[model samples]
Target: IISVGALAGMFTMMVTMIYSSSRLIYAIGRDGLLPRWFGHVKGHLPENALWTVVLIIAIMGGLVPLTQLVNLVNIGTLIAFALVSIGIIPLRRHQAFNNEGFKVPGYPVTPIISFLFCLLLMTQLSVETWIMSLIWFAFGLVIYFSYGIRHGHVAEKRIE
Candidate 1:
């Protein structure tokens, strides 16, 4: 019963997440984040993004301890959610796209709930995991500031 539900949920979640994540990578690559090859869809999917994700998961699944991997995913996802909540305010005010689509309801409450939920999960992560996340974030910052800032389309538009 419970196990069946859990398995079903896991399958549903994985399929949806992979679909969404690959689409994001496809969009990003289309916007010139990675490479033109990544933007190309194969059989109605972002082939490069899907393959890259599969390769990464396979490597990590083989290498990482199951317990540590769960905690690591939790910490990473929580932090990303928290950042999304915080960053949305600025983006909403200075929107690049006009109100062509539906806007979020309960703006304040929504973001607050999202932030607190992320914070709670983040707090459950181990100190070592936090440290590792910090290191990864620092490296990401370096890459963003170096290559992304210099050559990013948004930055180019800003400069122009």
Candidate 2:
């Protein structure tokens, strides 16, 4: 029973990750940050992006050690959370004032605390994980500057 339950949970998490990653890839492709082939849709689904995600997952699963993969995911998630927590401050300040939406109870303090905690957690990750994450980020930066910046909708709007 315990083994079955664990398998089921793992399967569910795998499916969720695959779906979300595919959607992210599709969105980036649709926004011209990635090649258009990834944006292809069929039967109301981003089939190409889904397949791409599946292939990537399969390759990683086969080539990468599970512990390393887990660590990388942990660091990546922590970094994303930290960025969001820090980003909220600037976002709130830059946006037009509106009292109509949900507000953070402690405002800046809450977000600052959240960001600091995330940073602390990230520091606990292995150095290899940090190096991998930094390398991936650098690659993303290169792609964004070389192709996405010129091909994205924002660039088109700017030109017009």
Question: Which residue segments of model 1 deviate by more than 4 Å?
Answer: 93-103, 138-151, 155-160
Model 1 per-residue lDDT tens digits across residues 1-160: 9999999997896677677778877887777655667689888889998887777777877997877777776787787789989777666666565755756678767887889988987887889888877886898688667655654566445611
Clashes of 2: 0
Write model 2 residue lDDT over 1-160, tens digit each, in one string. 9999999987897898898999999999999999999899999999999999999889999999999988877887788899999988877775465645867779989999999999999889888998988998999999999999987777433311
* Alpha-carbon runs more than 4 Å astray in model 2: 1-9, 97-99, 155-160
Q: Each model's RMSD to truth, in Å? A: 3.2, 3.1
What would the TM-score be for candidate 2 when compared with the true structure? 0.85
Candidate models: Cα lDDT each? 0.76, 0.88
Best by lDDT: 2
lDDT of 2: 0.88
Clashing residue pairs found in predicted model 2: none
Error of 1 at 108 (Å): 1.8
